[model samples]
Target: MANQTPESNQPSNTQTYGFPIYAADWIPEETVRSKIDKDQDNSEDVGGESSSSTSRSCIVLAGGGGEGRSGIKNVIVICRVDLDTKSLAEQPLGRIVLGTDLPYRMAVHPRGGGLVCALPNSCKRFDWESIISPREGDQGGEEGEEVINELKDVGQQLALAFNQEGSVLAAGGEDGTLRIFEWPCMKTLLDESKAHASVKNLTFSESGKFLVSLGGPLCRVWDVNASAAIASLSKEKDEMFAYCRFSVDNAGNEVLYIAANTERGGSIITWDTTTWKRRRSKLMKNYSISAFNVSADGKLLALGNMEGDVLIIDSTKMKTHQLVKKAHLGLVTALTFSPDSRCLVSVSFDSRAKLTVIEKTPEKRKGSKLAGDVVVVRVAIRGFLLFLDGKGDHRQRK
Candidate 1:
């Protein structure tokens, strides 16, 4: 779907990737910065023009036509987002064809080591070096190096996550196995063959001391140091848990947020980390949530519904801060927050991706008596279109 540009706002751009997009994530800022530094060093050695000063970010997208003979190739793509221009590069910076293997899920290492992708029957690792600096004959949108032999035979993972420090890796498999390993070394820390009926979602706490896993109607919190499930969370009547996230409140207390759906609508349920008890439940939408994400700062929450609407909520008030109607033609497949938490990128099965910029509004007082101590804050969300696979046009939406 083409986004309409508003005269008062920056224009949004749209790209169609031809194949369905199942996974998307921002390349770590450290990885991009290191690449820029390496490029500068190479340019200086050859006395070539230096890199552009304009700020840019990179993101990786993975999806394909699966194992069937659909003609379209399974691939991973890297695209650069130009912050100055507020648009994606005309063409992808890199693309890795995966033959018939479809990448269903991915988790990029926080320290720029590489990324691991979940395929049909197993998972594979793709190093950052191979992706950013393709070998000779790897140009012109062709495949890069072969998938790294590491992680081979690791069963089909439905959920993958890395600890905040990137020192630990967690993978939840479709066979109800939960594995946690020391990063890079692959030493097992925890391996449960029956952690759930089928793992669906996983996340690590900020302190890296706890991990949360969601499968079927039960959501489990694991004590990382003990390597055992400490708490088992179950859904209330008619409420189904779809996703879970870890965040910290203003007072620095850890909070667990779960996206849930009921016959009435979609809701955000908060739980206290200390007791693992439901703290509050707020209904956010009338449609089932298809995608959900929490910003790094823990101040904002973003979610997309099956009805193609996106809503940004204030974590403090548990109220809607911004809502974008019909952001996608299909159900949102993934949503991720930028490292700086200033922007959010969302992708859908409709072969479209969007970049939504979050701008904070000036603070306003709610009451005269509380003016000195309390202030109400709101944010404006503006979305830009990102066209991929050489299809579609650019337009801005506010």
Candidate 2:
């Protein structure tokens, strides 16, 4: 979808200034509904609607905050959209809100029905709310009981990745500390103390056994289950590693990858996760790399830079597959792929998130085909990204 214009109040049709900075609240309800419906249709149209298919779900990132002062509320939810008949299949189900007062980051538990969010400035832990039945308007309070509250400081700046089964949640912080937690309990399972800097991004291999943490100049690999540090990768140059991903090969082994920003510009590095062995590293010809993602099948890597542009790389062959410019406006912050791996969703400072559906050619279908089944929902948050998920323990009522 394009940026919205002022007079029209409709998303801007033309890409004027690279990243359009508008209020996320400007996205109208009708537009969200339309985007959801368009995403639900299975026909092969780039931007067309088709017959309704099965129910669809999505993980959304709600982020906004400036420095020591909290400009945006600490409210962020990984919303799970339920689709039916080109319309909302059900009210969007999400976790409890983190409140608007905190500077936080969140991640969808690798497994379904769970999530992890953390405060960047403090040593606060995250809690998990058990799965309860969805109520009218997608409310969860009407049904189940509250679970448990756990606390663990995730140091400055945090990012998380879940194991394949979603059983374990791995959190990395700015202090270069990496912690692993078991689901439900939110108990710390493992902590890697050697990392000295804050972690910017991370991900798990498809096998769920290995975890990769991007520490900019330094990269560390861990065995999530064993909670052991397996290997470390770094660059002699003092480039800040901005993003890192663990892409699995056909053998289920972890292949490490990182995008670093340097004085010269930006570059991407790939290594063997198991051995900390270097595979290939390349400096981006243009566009400063901001964030990147690896497809579940381990075939494609999507990279976004400061220019709101995206570069798709073939991991196995180690080559650039496709490069998309103006992928999003403003600073490209985060990226993720659907379980099926056909669609890529990118969020940016432009105050808008974009869903780029890649039409997988026959050669690209290494795994599931989600292109024809992908749908995009326009997420708009007013005031702040409400974190309470509203399903609080009313029983814990004072």
Quote each prediction's TM-score: 0.82, 0.66
Please report, as a residue range, the 10-residue window in candidate 1 with the lowest summed lDDT: 377-386
- Candidate 2 ranges beyond 4 A from true positions: 1-51, 65-74, 77-98, 120-157, 192-194, 250-253, 361-398
Model 2, 76-161: lDDT tens digits are: 33333333321211222233333332434555544334334455454333322322122254222412322224333334556766
- After TM-score superposition, the amount by which residue 133's alpha carbon in candidate 2 deviates from its true location, in angstroms, is 10
So what's the TM-score on candidate 2? 0.66
Clashing pairs in 1: 11-396, 12-395, 12-396, 13-385, 13-386, 13-394, 14-387, 15-386, 15-387, 15-388
Regions of model 1 farther than 4 Å from truth? 1-12, 34-54, 134-151, 365-398
On residues 1-398, what C-alpha lDDT tens digit does candidate 1 reach at each position? 12333552342445566668888999886766777456445644785433354466888888878885877667777766666666654345556777778899999888887788898877777876656664455332323233434456766789999998999989898889898998878788998988999999999999999999999889999999999999999899999999999999888899999999999999899999999999999986477899999999999999988877788899989987888888789799998888888888888887677777786855555455466443332111111222332234322321
Cα displacement (angstroms), candidate 2, residue 346, comes to 0.9
Best by lDDT: 1
Query: How many Å off is the CA of 228 in candidate 1?
Result: 0.9
